[model samples]
Target: MDTTTNALRWVFLFLMHHPDIQDRMCTEIEGVVRRDMIPMLEDRSKLPFCEAVCFEVMRLGKGSPHTAPHTMKQDTEINGCVIPKGVPVVFNLNSINSDPEIFPDPSTFNPDRFLTGDGRLQGTEKMATSSMGRRSCMGESLAMMELFLFVMALVQRYKIKIEP
Candidate 1:
């Protein structure tokens, strides 16, 4: 629940801070979904910009700063460093999420970064928000659906504003 709530709060904060982005999201939502009805899961694929905004928010927000602790099953070498068996390892999601190679000017809030030239929402494997392997987040799909519905509904109903 914390993860979902935090994600929502961060997205809303980003939208409030960037009215241009917020307006773009609203426009995108209005185009795909009728204002008289709430957005449905089926509408997710049509809202590329809105999906990008959600992805951008998750990437920049550091929803899961570190993945669950992992232990080495056997001795291994990574980049010339020996990792002995039974050693615990923690993956830092922030480093990957902010990597300049994958996300240029990563500190900047740019939803277009998650979009292709043809305007499609790109995958977020590089962000590494969810744990890998058997420990991966089981609610990933649910979380995404909730994000789309909640964000779409909110943007469609009202314009977000940041009070100074």
Candidate 2:
């Protein structure tokens, strides 16, 4: 179905599988935001661990590997290969998501990757979920905001786990 909805499902599944992560995210939510206050976009930065969880979910649950086709504006050399102008290009989200060079042990659902040594939110804006730059998904921010709020609210209210 929808890619954002798919990723959201993955997030809950991951949390169900990893109670430690869910607890940590809940702790972050509990410690940072007031119980009566609804989590907002501004609160996102205050909860780095939660953001990390979201980033990790986005990284692993990329529903569509290849993006919409785009044509190169000019000759572009990437790494070593050269792409001529007018050539079509489609970024593979899976490739970037699983690239060992960028994410060590890429297959693991390690939210810590988005955190720094002291446990602060790092540069997760570079995640492949929305691609990058002008060509990125127009609703990326809205999607992320929805995801952040959802995960925060859900974890705070419920103990996610396997039913069986």
Q: Provide the RMSD of all predictions against the true structure, rounded to 1 decimal.
A: 1.3, 1.8
Task: Give candidate 2's TM-score.
Answer: 0.91
Best by TM-score: 1
Local accuracy of candidate 1 as per-residue lDDT tens digits, 19-63: 999889888888888878998989988998998888888889888
For model 2, give the 10-residue run with minimal summed lDDT.
Answer: 123-132
The local distance difference test score of each candidate is 0.85, 0.85
- For each candidate in turn, the TM-score is 0.94, 0.91
lDDT of 2 at 59: 89
Q: What lDDT score goes with residue 23 in model 2?
A: 87
